[model samples]
Target: NRADGFASDSVTVLDPAAGTLTFLSEAAKLAVEEFVSRYGEGGKENFIKEHILKNFYAFELMMAPYTVGHLKMSFLLEELGYRLQDDDRFKLYLTNTLEMEELAQTELPGMASLSEESHLAGKVKKEQPVLVILGNPPYSGVSANRGKWIDDLLKKGYTRSDGYKDDGYYQIDRKPLGERNPKWLQDDYVKFVRFAQWKIDQAGEGVLGFITNHGYLDNPTFRGMRQSLLNSFNEIYILDLHGNSLKKEKCPDGSKDENVFDIQQGVAIALFIKKKGEKKDCKVYHSEIWGLREEKKYDWLLKNDIKTTDWRKLSPKSEFYLLVHRDESFLRSYEKYLKITEAFPLNSVGIVTSRDSFVIDSDKEALKRRIRMFRDEKMPDELVKQTFNLKDKSNWKLKVVREKVRKDEHWEDSITKILYRPFDIQWVFYHDNLIERPRKEVMRHMMEENLGLVSVRQVAEGIFNHAFVTDNIIESRVTLSNKGIAFLFPLYLYSDTDKKETGNPNKKRSLGSTMMLFEPKAEYTIKKPNLSPQLVERLTCQYKKTPSPEEIFYYIYAVLYSNIYRTKYAEFLKIDFPKIPFTKDYKLFSKVAEYGKRLVDLHLLKSVELDSPVAKFQGDGDERVEKLRYDGGEKCVYVNRSRYFEGITKEVWEYQIGGYQVCSKWLKDRKGRRLFLDDIKHYCKIVTSLQKTMEIQKVIDNIYPEAEKETIEFENK
Candidate 1:
């Protein structure tokens, strides 16, 4: 039998002070005994050294970061009849691969005189032709690989030889990707892939393989990178292992699917092959494996190879050369509709308060107190930070805030009402200097009475049903379950003015103004309909009647909430902002618009229908949510040991907005806080709103088919 080499006990023997040397000695003895028994005692060492140590190239090309790893690797090699010696080749390198550099000067001119790290760097970079590079690079969205060499290489791949440094221009197809924030492309895994690709390209003909985060397979931001890969390689193979926990992915058979690695991000095995001589057009092949972790890793992957595995040939197109399979027919049909941004023509991302704890509060008084303390010149910056529990971040720092606070004149006036979450109103200090990203240009409309549609450009979780109405300033994460920012598309655009006007508070400033002035004498901020005039004219011509902007907004809301629309074009919605399909039939448009208006009223908690809620708060207790759980049989949700909310059905209890389960998330946020009478009533109203939303969605779905049958198509400008 082969010696075990104490492999099973390696973890226990890792501690150097815990007799690790003794364990290694025992393991070595076992290997020697096994070798002596296999051969003769006298010549066993010579035979093992000559045949195994010298011949096994793997033993002469090993690298380990730490002493324990080096010891374990050496122990394993010794068990296989190889032993380390003074004259042996430099294999065990104790160096950071990302930080490795060639030696400036050596004792002698040869590599032998240099350190192991320097020698390995020289060998990999110049001496050896790396035909194959394969490894699982770490996945970090906020990559720490800021080294000059790697960053320069990454920039080189994305840029042309002409040295063009335009804002959005990339080298892939010599066109701009038009991404606002493509920071995800700078992930560590992506950087490593770029590094490996650079190394392989330098060799002329080589293969690069990596099992990394699968986001690049279909993410729109990675389009440039995908095209770059196609331009470099002759053949590319992608084996998508679908197990993204954040998306809650399941096997096709309705069974639980798990990731091979203990990670939330889905992973894919990508192999890029570049052959010698004239390069041909890159051939892309894709496959997906989804099942139990063990079944996928052991049964499927172990049994499959490049030639054995079945792969579907793909012709990656321009704009986005996505590696995953897509329904081309659906994409073509879906592209006919008008995008939300194109319809509204004006939108901005919601406010991003980096110091949410310091700047925002559930209680108005608490926010006022913080602002007062912040404005006080007596209090130290560090003391204020500690009192508010504020940490210094890249965007917001105490010293910078202090400097801005000194010059501020209207600190008290900055406190404003904001929609922190769905149906969750909170107070925030909305000053440009106080808040990290106040988004003043868009928020000014909300500062007064206004309505805005909240949505996300991309949906990474649950569904693309994130559309909501907000009459107040919203947080960046108002619609998103993840770290993504939500955009606010207001119905009316407001412009700043220095012109002061004296008029009655109830009277409107102008004929076009949608809102009346709250104060008797104030600066008149001009407001106009944010709708596109050309699109409105097209809609008016199609219906033979001019539609009001409010009618258009409601019509859009209804279409976005339609179950059929969301399901039919679900794939398209995941990548970009939603598109609204205009119906030629005026009756269908009117009906959907009415339903949408009701939904908006209900969401804003202004509808009289919310007075009589279906769900009721029952039981007598502190009303503090301890461990929220649902009793499916009883149709009740337990907030604490004794208190519970009755009449909440399974569907209502599990209804998701954006990616959050509304009923559960509301309770979860107030886990330790006691629910007041108003809070209890508000929860009931939220439940009713969701229940009505579902009912309205079903109606929209029924009417959506009729609308789609005779739709008005817009020409792309």
Candidate 2:
């Protein structure tokens, strides 16, 4: 060791034989050698001196003006050391700038080297049977170029024998984003696992362990990453640190809290074993996040049991229900229910371009129209003029006049223009209003399927304030206004009534007992776009399949009316089901339903019909289509309206079998884009069967295989 110093303008390097030498004696060397042998190696370069000297000068030259006092010396020295130890590309340039000040100055490795010396070594020796690899990795993700570097590295590391490539390290930048930049598809901690695994493969004798963002445990974005980990690692330990740790206010008396990590954030720490064939789940011990004093990141883990089960069997929705709708009012009203169950609805307030054109509401045209209309009407005329400065006086003046008189007219045109029709909120029913006439037909209308007629046997006694609108051919609920009455007959009946209307039947209207409401299907009259008739015949060129300009409107008149009637009637299917995945709706399983050979089953519900005389009268063209003759179609159908009584709190498995239908390869050979119905049904059955087995096992354990001898008398006795 040489301890020679140099002045600012000079450079020097002292050979090992120089003055002020410091070396361990022969006896001490033997002791250190024994320790080194145990760890496998020594005699490696103590420091990459040349690399350090280069970066030191470069950092000084660049930061001379900004640095002060010891900051100048420390900054240059650290940069030089980092460049030398990390083997980064900037080392050579840094060395050129440092000019090799003195033997001692150039020998110091960068700040990173002092703390992470062992990790910086590029060499690997497989001396141990297995080593536990572990670390906390940086959690930052940012890049200027679509993460091409990451893609390149991952592609290079792929292999077939270990299923490394198939773990699904694929690019996801093509996915869509909202107004802000898309979150990085992968987090930094997961990246550490990948890098660690790569290094282990090179060494050939290490089991990787790491604590990363808890996101891998739950976020859908990491589905591929999680699958890769599961395939490679045998045992998995997940510590979910999710909760607000800090007080709502920063300090007790308006002062800042000193704890830097106290910011309310969630974290996940995972421990993965590299050796395959171990248990799938591991015993996880969670301490406070970062093991901060008095800060248990997983205090909840202590109070609540940490359950372990087959990773695949775990359900994301099991603990919480999601109601996914854009309607704020619906969400607010349902938020209370979320405490007990998970139920979220899709946004119900939707926009449509026309009755037959499109269904997507966030189209550019729609957004532009909305913003413009909001500006024109919401802001004052003087303010608008000052801001936009009218390009066309006539147009501006017309808008101003409309704003004063008929405000809606100012932007009605823009608001109505769109490529797709919007969702109609009227299609859903709330509990505020309910009336009943026919239920089955209404179901058919809403569901776009035909349901056969079924008699409405009142569960209670009631009389007809007006006639029940039922026919062997067509059925539907007639509006109170259309029935020329103020309310429903509200009839109830016993099972003994004559099949004919003329039996000694109960006539008094009863407000009790379940009464079935059935109505015919609502008819939609698509304005039949005149495309190349050839294109029209192909499903691909039709609605939702083609980019052709046409309208698609699901009229709300029927849905609104039905919802109102259903609100009034206490007779509705009571079963609560989850929202239908891959679609914007939920389902209600009818308690009254029984399988029928032809009609399947009937779920008693109060729903409205598009074919109602009143609905038809208001829309002439639609009415004609509703009444258009069908070849032997049933008059009435069962309606199964989804319930909002409970929140969704269960995870339901949804499997898709067929590809997409809009572009089925069988029909047009558009691979990767189309799906067939066969695929859908097949997948549905498989997923349903799997879920059914789990459910059956639960029932068998709870209800079956247990004897109840409370009433076991023999018939002979």
Candidate 3:
């Protein structure tokens, strides 16, 4: 069974037990002792004793039988001529690969004073020279491997500690990553990679290969990890298999692309090689494989080796050492513009109500009734959950919600309007205690009549189209697709003011005020514009005029809607918040601001231009939406088998905002519900608004080139 002229002792078969009967059975079938006992020359037992048993060494550590029956079955196979017997060379111990260093230091009870297998594994891990480490480790975001040894190793090399404090981790270059959430770095696959890297570093030189999630390739959060790998290895090879369905990825030729595995997240095979000397400057080579899973992915992997496949040399830069290609020229220009976050100093993510089913509803009365039931002490939690079809999550438990609600005396006052989706307004029970994440810091500004810009920080769908204006409280995903959360940047901030007695009792408070004192005294909340004073001053100096906050807000909105701006800097917009390039020309700024104001009014559905409808509701039925379909030839949208909206154009019907087909989504969300006269008129106005928006966008695009020609550059201070 041995190689020609090679001793059996030269090769050792070592594997961790899979804790399955199938693994044991397969191991017995493949053993050389079984072969010698079955068909060797002379007596079978004597031949195995003389040759097979004396030379062959196979150890299965971490042996764990699922049941007593499985344990008995293993012994039965050994008794029935399987020749599976434990000698000095064959020992089993319960060991975890990630914690070999800790396990090697501890002693475990066994037939002798200590487990020989444990001792050997410890010795191999601490003292042996491992030249190669390769495997497809498990991928779990909520990894179960939280041992102190592995966590310490990760802190030392790959990621920041739990408190997010930098403790001399080699992964960080000079500055902290400044990430609020880096939980993805704790994935089981990442831990395994870190472990392998540590082992190779201990040995001073080795090769590490693994197939893992491709998120780290360009994800802004993994800059440190990418830098750490670059610092440790001499050469790195990456074969990205782009097939992320969540991002709705497509091949270069617009063909359908699928993942090699049945997972929404894409994967890549990464190879890291370290030389046996001082670490050299790292050279990274990258390649991509796309198309069908079997033909393109599997066939290519089966056919090509590292030397055979083509690779493109990449030069990763500082700050964010992204693995993917970037347009350096475009990025250099884009970086000069003022970021939205810098322009607006105060902003926050929108409200996240974990129990959306129970807390939010289109009908205000229905929401009121649900709240009444929730506040009722007599109503059992289970019954209340059943009534609202509420499913308790780990964060939003019924018991906790009931206790919070029971203590609040003014829970009814928390009911308010929310922009649930694009052009879809709904009432939400907005209580900090009841809702999972109310985002009170920013949302309090929108409690009354206030304006806020809704946009996502990152674009995973390869587009920068999710931007809108809201005048009310917004849900976390109000206008987002692809699991992206929307952030709200309110134009003004509100704070409580002391109640002062006014002479007039019947005088109405200002439109934006939320609280009022009763009995002849009125209280008005103070409102302050949430704009950076320094930015305003810089723009004022550049334009020779002090621009109002509303003017700046509208100008930003117009810039975001420009087709040229979106297309030219699409890659830059994908990584972070959109930046606004201020035009030094006052005329261009005024024109763009005028258009932005019109768009804002149109989106809010308060524009005088919307008095005229482009589409008309025809046909007579129950007015209930059963299904929605559009006919291009007829230029009509059918709500059911009978009723349809006429005079609708194909462009208007297929219009999208925030990754949602507007005309269809509005109707689809109202399925099986009767549409009133106001609802019918509203749909027509929405169609008109979309048509106007498309026309306005083209107008902005025409003047965008002139606007970009003379831009204001702000000082770093």
Q: Which candidate gets the maximum TM-score versus the true structure?
A: 3
C-alpha displacement of 214 in model 2, angstroms? Answer: 1.1
Worst 10 residues of 2 by lDDT: 589-598
- The collision pairs in model 3 are none
TM-score of 2: 0.31
TM, every model: 0.80, 0.31, 0.82
Please give, for residues 1-717, the per-residue lDDT of candidate 3 as tens digits. 244211133322222222333433343335445454455634544433443334322223233443432464446445634455565222233456566543324453543323454566566556655555655666788978788877877665433212223332335566666665677778877777776676667666767777788877887677777877777778999999989998889997889999999999889999988776755689999999999999899999999999988998988877677787766667766677888877877888888887788889988898888788887899988998888787788767887878888787767667888998889889888887668888887887786457889887778775678889999889988766553578889986666441235432112246445542221122334666677766787777877877777888999999999989988988877777887888999888999999999999999999988898888999977789998889999999999988988888998888877877889999998999988888899899999898889999999999989999978875431
Clashes of each: 0, 89, 0
lDDT of 1 by residue, 45-142 (tens): 56445533332111111222334545664676567556767675313333334443655545545334446456654455543444456566678999
> lDDT per prediction?
0.72, 0.26, 0.73
What tens-digit string does per-residue lDDT give for candidate 2 at 335-429? 22211011111101111112111112323455444345434556765664455343224223535443443433323222221111000111111
Give model 1's TM-score versus the native structure: 0.80
Give the C-alpha lDDT of model 1.
Answer: 0.72
Ordering by TM-score? 3, 1, 2
